[model samples]
Target: MTTEEKVARRKLSLLELAKDLQNVSKACKVMGYSRQQFYEIRRNYQTFGSEGLVDKLPGPRGPHPNRVSEEIETAILEHSLAFPTHGPVRVAQELALRGIQVSSTGVRGVWGRHDLLTRHERLLRLERAMREQKIELTEEQVRHLERFSPEFRERHIEVHHTGELVAVDTFFVGTLKGVGKVYLQSVIDCFSRYAWGRLYTSKLPITAVHVLNNDVLPFFEAHNAKVSTVLSDNGREFCGRKDQHPYELFLQLEEIEHRTTKVRRPQSNGFVERLHRTLLDEHFRIQGRTKWYEALEEMQQDLNDYLVTYNTKRPHQGRNMKGSTPYAVFKKGLPKATKKEPRKTAENTA
Candidate 1:
């Protein structure tokens, strides 16, 4: 029985034994209960009948009033509606800054009670929007998309400091000097966010493989490492040629693992794809030149500088409250590279 039940039973037995004893001190000694407890039990028995011996009435129902109230909950829901991408912990902090105290759990409870879509749901919605543009998605396809989602944190995509996972993709910068338009080959380390890229006149498989094998691989090896895996979207350059794409052949010869995201589902390769957009906006697009090839080498140098700044200086929002840089994290987990000066060349003139 519970402690309260045991106490009640002892109190009841003492009362019965007290009836047979005229001396109060003697009865208290025999029952092993203090005189004050005897008096209290007698008073309770006379006042509320037998039910008074049970535990006190259950406390107020539902969540405590000291916790988030209905008004505060409504405010949180409204705030979430305004900024659907914000997470509960971030919202809680924002509310605290406004002199409104609320726990992350409280905010989550409110959201859960309202059946609101979470941050992952928001990303999934956007992914769905992109998927709709290509073709109708089947249930199995939808499940696979969800499984590979960037927001799904359960599945660990193994990547180490600088060379574990490199995502490569081709993007069009703009019309290049002496060339109508040029395609760019870009590779970024998933861990440190260090990017190595080159511009080419065509999107041919041979050219893509040359960039990966001759330029990219050599650079990585010179830095004293080899990529453990290469992730890419379903692009013609990566998928073997009519017989064997150079990328596939290189992977087989080097014994490097290769993975590709589903066709038309960019979210599977979201990290590098997002980096691509950032580079275009910050470097190429803002250059205001229709033809980029005339200054391709300069652009490449600038891109490398940008990558260094991105890894060593710029703070990542996804990291903790300390605003840590990707390079800081990379250094903590991996061996340091020997410093080397950047090469000076005519094409590299900014």
Candidate 2:
């Protein structure tokens, strides 16, 4: 059956053979055992029943004697729970500074015993600990969780309809030969992913305001919709004194709320980030290699053409898009109570 069972059967057979032959020396020779081994087997079987016949590894048993004390083990676990991203060497060094002398190998051994040898395992332990206890997380711990946890990343701005919330950002399109550097002022509706962008030589507040005033708001107006909130990062172009900053003043004048994302957390404004990626992959990279542009107008014209196709022609497979164009989703997403007859296009207007 099992290795232990096989060994027990062999031992029992040796005893039985010794009885049947009535000769201990002959039985020992036949069973490949010394006379001393035969007596030891018989003594074990007689004393402890069958379990004593099973093989047991010879060791001191339980935790190794040289393992760090419980106090040091608790400190190592607490430090790991606080900063799950730290490696064993760093953990050991930190403990050393605190007068808790523990080698990296010792730290690793403790982690192994506790099933927390990997960074992910430590993070999971921290998350479970937070769920089970009423511990207030520090800012560093919050940032660490957000950095590595996909569930944290998935928590994003909620928008119900088109024009409810919009995201704006500045992107550095490569430098021109004559012009020093080209920057793109990009904006996108958070709900439908309808994007608008304009290239400029600088990323100033005026440039940010100009894109909203000229392209973004006009498109919303044409669709009989109004943007309620504008989300941007804590960049100079978007955030400053409410009375002095051009972007702030523009939002105030238009009666739209200006919301800035958490500092250094770009995923909060993921709509604009995804838009920039699409522009880079589908438009800029392809256009840069195909044509040599001398002026900003040429690049702008090409960008406009691509945008038109992106809004009205390209089938978007984003969340809830259902293979519809961005413009179609933008139109359909408007609340029925707020829906009005959209302004005529150039074809209809003409």
Candidate 3:
């Protein structure tokens, strides 16, 4: 097929899925095209028909096409080294501030040629160059190397029952007059998604341990179940390599395994992170009066009420527990316990 026809067919398929799903984000994710790219493709198809769908190759027609100068290229590399976290847009802005003329697209082209697609990738190359003495280092890059913590950084898993895995995360829930800055520590079973949370003034390891000790463990223990593993980020509160990391110690004492998300990969803990976002929208935002809370006790009470309704009443739309509340699913997964008393029988069988 001609390039135009091939491109047209692809665009038609994307448009059809977009129509079917009625969700730009989901459709774009499935088709591997960004939302902006999809919208542009749709617009071109609607306006110019199939002819507009043809992909255009880059570069000038003349022998002397526009090219980045050696000076400009050097500047780009130096800026990248200095601000390893900056992307093409920010780099272009920085260049403009330094009286250099370059479009974001041009900066991106330079980055692509260098294979510096992300800040993390740039940081790696910058470090290797410094080690090999390949490139001269700037003061800013040197300082950043000293300050950056690389450890600050998965999804397919089937959970058949509660207590197989639980995710715990701390969320900033704004400040209160008596409580100062408030934080919510949430623990959710990966299977049933039954959640428990407590508000606290500190994010210390003890606070997290408290949530597990007083809340999660007791509830599960009452049902004769035990938490197999807990998933969280590398935050010191969740876990660390230190010998005295209280959170890690607590998990060990409870015979629960601790698993952390990969560095820079929060989507690995998608379940808990999504819960935080939903709480931010529904509970925190709605109850926030003038962005300040009245009292800690009252706030905690409100949150507890919400949690009760969420666990016992609200039907979950999660993949496994469709049309079932979290509590309903949790009970089903509970290990069957034999009756304490044997059945009584009459002795007069004669």
Candidate 4:
């Protein structure tokens, strides 16, 4: 028998001996227990019978305290379903705001029991599927891909004019409204991290080119920035030739030099891709809206506010030693010839 069971049997024997001997001290000596302990066991056996000797009775009891109640668990399930991308930590904070005292670990345990850990896993599966569909390259083909990658170039350490190098990419927002998907076409100035984005219904090359022409180019022109080289991934939308493909006409019109990253290597365009993830985590997922496209106007407005804050107000790590925004960095690097003087100065002098 286990030690606990053996101890329980001995305690029962001691209780019987105490009753039979009619002397607590005599029973205590025989049982190797103190007089106080003998009397306690005798009281327990008298009050609760044989079961009392198996385990000590729970200490003086009142009503049982409730932990996370059923109502709170239901709320957690609802919140998680509505916002699948949010982790337990965020959910715990949200629950706290609703006056529920729950831990992130508690929420995670609940999620684990309910089979709700699918967001990241789904992304990994999708990435794996994409990789499987991709053709394996020979050493020569791999070398060719590397030659075309922007990472092949040594990043210029010197301060350069704005728009000398632009990073461009398309990233999908999480599945929206449980039906259609939304794509974000984004471009960031390599020097400033000043970014612009457009929401598209599709990730088609035609749609991408349209956003670049209509929205991105105008923003750059308005800021007096000109993109000399555009860096992007080898995704079919970005790298496919026009004559061989459906988007050939649109591609020819943009006329900018296009460079692709090594296939499946997102780190080559790490800055813009990192921004994509940050946008989803910090803004999209936290906002807790189920149907994102239905709130497209609001989403776009919030994104613009975020972009303006990122460019003009937020401190950028990519900014040089000056410790300024991307906008500030780009302004600081303006060519002296391009800098404009105040007009009407002589006329106003009189």
Candidate 5:
């Protein structure tokens, strides 16, 4: 960039930093600029755009009045472009060999005005000059260059209808009043927010498969719906590389696709996560501690009553299904996935 371009970039950067920090004093302190200068640059940029940053040299419009001749200045720029690896000192020495007699400081000043001081900056200019050429990049290089991006924002998925996707996950509900520590395996519809879960004493793969088979599948059958995909995290129960996982085998036999969230990416399974939080606040935290329930069967009965209230009576606050219950929204959904006749899933005691 030219000196004018550098000044404009500095001014623009300061303004952006100030807006982001939301404090002019702190922006100035970090950017190493005085408040007065910041205000001047901001005012000019607002009034006249980036062109205002150019130094309004008050003298002649042509080259330096008495300094290096036009011929010598042209020689300096040509030599610098021809040999970008050389710096100001080397350029001056090259000019001396030709009897041009220009100091290193003079050559540096010329280079600064033209913005050709750094080899990286010059190479960028050369690349711009060759913009019409086709450039192919390797896959690894493309992946490695992604660090230059600002940040990764979550992409929102559009919900066409209920049963298009189901997200399942296991949440660790605190120990019941009389029962030991337990878990709840929940499967929730992404569209209607309809949910179903079962209390389990163990967090095994079989527990997850039973939740899907007994609760989730029956619910889908009642509405004549098919789950296009079941999303989950990479827990041992819902995910594995081999076919030994009972949950994976169950999904396969049921003709439903199983998808796991990327490693370290829990947001991909956010629907089930939100459902877990809601249940924690409304169901488990409120009723489980009111009276000690020694038997897991008693807790299961209490959970079923709450699930009815949640699906049929509670008014959901979702934007898509306003003033409607989960059961109401679910009744209106149509199945999208292909349904196949049920078959027994393979069982192996490894």
Candidate 6:
């Protein structure tokens, strides 16, 4: 019925024909098989029964000798996970940089076996890895995923603890009739989403420094937490020559690292961007329509009151907030090392 079965029947008939004709040469001629093949088939039947009759393709069985080793394949896969946007040739080159000798063909072979031939398939693999918490997402990976997949735009920046990273931005509130244009210097703790903002007539380097010095640092100081990093866009207010810029000098004085977002990539500083959107939607739009403001001081007062309620009372449903107030998360997320115990003196120990 099957091809193997048919082949086995034909071989069995050859043996019968040889026995009936009483001549091996005549049976081989009628069966269209060489004398050597007939002898080999007969021997296989005697030794392995009908199974040996099934045609096994002539080649090395199992893995090909030319295929990459398991360790190299694993390296390729891990590299792919980290940078899914890289093509086979790029991957090969990257591996080469690491002193791993792998050809572009080898990389393609690995991708093919894993069904990661397309960029989308590779990105989907990355998404799964992120969801499973197997790997931390880098900014570049985040950018790639956000560009390729719309659903991935909901992914939040990963912050482990409070004061780990802080995002700062300058926002234009609106023009005050007598005061010209009003800008807001906004600072937010990326971990807790606790925010601070100040009203200014202009977005200058000093305005950015003033908010951090007067508002952000004091709050962190009260909690015994130190900011290690400040992220901002490449605005003149936030970024300039470290030796000359007021904001840069202030950051240097405070011993905090300043990191600017990539040019033209606003989402690189996404936490601050989201904060600006929230302020616009909840505070500015509502306050603008409902109440008439006479001066910047009046606007600042209302903003301060709103901020108190926002930080202490309003529940946030953000990534790890879990319906907790920013104030609560801020205090709870503080690193244990920050709350240092006083060194025991001889008198105290006694």
- lDDT of all predictions: 0.72, 0.90, 0.82, 0.71, 0.80, 0.89
Q: Give all TM-scores, in the order shown.
A: 0.49, 0.56, 0.51, 0.48, 0.55, 0.57
Model 1 spans > 4 angstroms off = 1-162, 241-243, 289-295, 318-322, 335-350
TM-score of 1: 0.49
Candidates arranged by lDDT, highest first? 2, 6, 3, 5, 1, 4
- Model 6 clash pairs are none
Per-residue CA lDDT of candidate 5, range 1-350, in tens?
Answer: 88877867877889999999999999999988999998998898888887776667787788665567779889988787677778888989998999888988888777778787788876766767568668898988666564343343244546788888898988887776666888888888888888898998778999998888778877777666777788889898888755787777778877788877767777667777778878888988887668677888887888889889988999988657788998888877765546655534445323
Q: Number of the top candidate by TM-score?
A: 6
Runs of candidate 4 with Cα error greater than 4 angstroms are 1-159, 244-252, 289-293, 319-322, 335-350
Clashes of 2: 0
The candidate 4 region of ten consecutive residues with least summed lDDT is 338-347
lDDT of 1 by residue, 142-213 (tens): 778767765652344555466778888888876666655667888877776666677777787777677776
Ranking by TM-score: 6, 2, 5, 3, 1, 4
- Residue-level lDDT of model 3, residues 76-135, one tens digit each, is 988998888988889999999999999888787778888987788899988887788767
Please list all clashing residue pairs in model 5, or write none if there are none.
Answer: none
Error of 3 at 28 (Å): 64
RMSD of 5: 15.3
lDDT of 4 by residue, 1-350 (tens): 98768988999888778779988788889879997887777777778877667665478754336445678788888777566677889999998999988898778767766666667743454455567886878999867765675665424333277777778888887555644677888887777677888776678786767766777666666665556677888777776654665434444444556767767767778778867877787667866465335555666787787778777987766536266887787676544445533322224645
Backbone clash total for model 6 is 0
Which model, 2 or 5, shows the larger lDDT? 2
**Mind giving the per-residue lDDT tens digits that candidate 6 earns over 215-247?**
988788778888989999989998888999988
Candidate 3, residue 295: lDDT: 77
